[model samples]
Target chain A: AQSVAQPEDQVNVAEGNPLTVKCTYSVSGNPYLFWYVQYPNRGLQFLLKYITGDNLVKGSYGFEAEFNKSQTSFHLKKPSALVSDSALYFCAVRAQPYTGGFKTIFGAGTRLFVKA
Target chain B: DVKVTQSSRYLVKRTGEKVFLECVQDMDHENMFWYRQDPGLGLRLIYFSYDVKMKEKGDIPEGYSVSREKKERFSLILESASTNQTSMYLCASSLRLALLSYNEQFFGPGTRLTVL
Candidate 1:
């Protein structure tokens, strides 16, 4: 019943310009959101997450995401894009059932291309 | 740091052959997961184990089975390798049920399996 969606199949950004990868979620109760990045021929690495507290979460590689409660969106952002930042980005959500424990759901992913 | 490692980086197998993919984690995580990754599908969970010898079916578990005999190792098995099963397989681990826990999962480099 819980799911996450990445709106873009691909995003092209010029170096030194801001970049964003949009994600939205549908879940029961409050949502636990996450961002992950995968380089070419590599596994995914955790970037950031938002469970409680601040809506603006800062993560590795100078990236950050804003969790919008009203819009049910968590978007990954960078002040300036870099060629190295070009990778596959996946948005995920954690589901905590009343019975305890948790499960994770991942989005289809967004391919980010940063042109230098 | 938590390190998750897969047994292989690349593998080639014939259709109908039994394929085994092994994974191990340095961290004594409570949860271990096997995921299948395709170009547009993102990460589809095949199976996950919350504890040693305890496994649960995930989103896509039709042709896959998993084993978690030890706390640090998890193995995924394809009963009959099909062309559709040819994809990247990723292993991951996470800390849960502990005093200090986050739903973040650490992933291995991944194994690219090609079933001909």
Candidate 2:
């Protein structure tokens, strides 16, 4: 079984300031991590994914996440925050099973509040 | 651009009433999924279909059923809607079965259902 943990329930940041949302995971095999954002009453939008690549992975809306193997963490970061960035973010992980398809597990979600 | 569309944006139902939430994807993707999103629970998979008429149970399948009569459409059915079942439902589609190359899912705008 695979699980993802997002420690922060809410993160506040000022405009133009950098922001980080922490995430960690527990899985049996290679990890396929993902980040998604959801606005009020909207569905989740895929921001990025880390399948197998360099540790630092860049995503949409000027967002990026770092995959730390030893730390078992994948933290989402943005150099500058925008008021439009205020939303709910979720971290997810799926193990690459030998049985053909993968089942993704999602975290509890982190609410980001970016103030201008 | 690929788009996933849900039939309803907002739904109001009562307990013991049967509910149907429909989703369609225009990309002709091989995999389709249904998930329920809560305030803090993030996204929990209810069911997924890899192909037409083939469904698999996801994390939370109890009290919920799904149908995929066509490859482009997936339907989620709640035999008895409860207060606990009131949440935002999301639909997503992804391409798979191609040997695990990097594949991302496209999501719909979501359907907000309320069971009283």
Candidate 3:
């Protein structure tokens, strides 16, 4: 089974400071990881993904994530936090099993509060 | 640009009432998915369809069903709305590309359902 875990329930950061949201995953096969953000009353917006490329993957809104194989983690990061960036962050992992059917498993989201 | 739209922004229903949540995607994608988002649960897949008229149960499909009679439209059905089922429903569509590059899943704005 493929599953993800977000250790933090919430994270607080000052505007202009760097931000990080942690996530770890367990999958049977190769990992296809993703990061998404959600605002209040809205759905998720794709942030970035890691398939087989560079460790650091850049995504929308100046967000990025690093995939660490040894640690089994894919943590979302931003160089400088913005107050508007306060929202919920989700980390998802796809189990690339040889089986034809597969689904993405998401972590219990982490709420981010960026203070102005 | 790929866009996904949900039929309603908010809905209120009583117990034992039948509820329908519709989703449409502008992109001609082959895969459509329905997920429920809770505060700490992040997102749990309720159902998914790989093609027209083909649906598959997801992680949490116990109280819900899905319809995908057409390529662009997917509808989630709740036979009896329950208070525990009150949550934000999100729809997503994505092309079934190679496993290495299929992490991009476009999502709708989501519908908030409250069951009394």
| Candidate number achieving the greatest TM-score relative to the actual structure | 1
- Give every candidate's TM-score on chain A: 0.95, 0.94, 0.95
**What digit string (tens of lDDT, one per residue) describes model 2 on residues B10-114?**
999999999999999999898999998877788898888888998888889999999999999999999999999988899999988565535777899999899
Write the residue-wise lDDT of candidate 3 on B1-116 in tens digits: 89999999999999999999999999899889999988788888999888899888888999999999999999999999999999999999988875444557899999999999
Preferred candidate (lDDT higher): 1 or 3: 1
Q: DockQ: which is higher, 1 or 2?
A: 2
| Candidate 2: Cα lDDT at B60 | 90
Interface RMSD of each: 2.7, 1.9, 2.0
Off by over 4 Å in 2: A98-100, B99-102
lDDT of each: 0.92, 0.90, 0.90
Give model 3's docking category. Answer: medium
Report chain B TM per candidate.
Answer: 0.95, 0.96, 0.96
- Candidate 2, A1-110: lDDT as tens digits: 57899999999999999999999999997888999998887778899999886999999999999999999999999999999999999998876643355678899999
Q: Which residue runs of candidate 3 sit more than 4 Å off their true CA positions?
A: A97-99, B99-101
Ten-residue region with minimum lDDT total, candidate 1 chain A: A94-103
- lDDT, residue A84, model 1: 99
Name the fnat for model 1: 0.58
The list of candidate 1 runs beyond 4 A from truth reads A98-101, B98-101
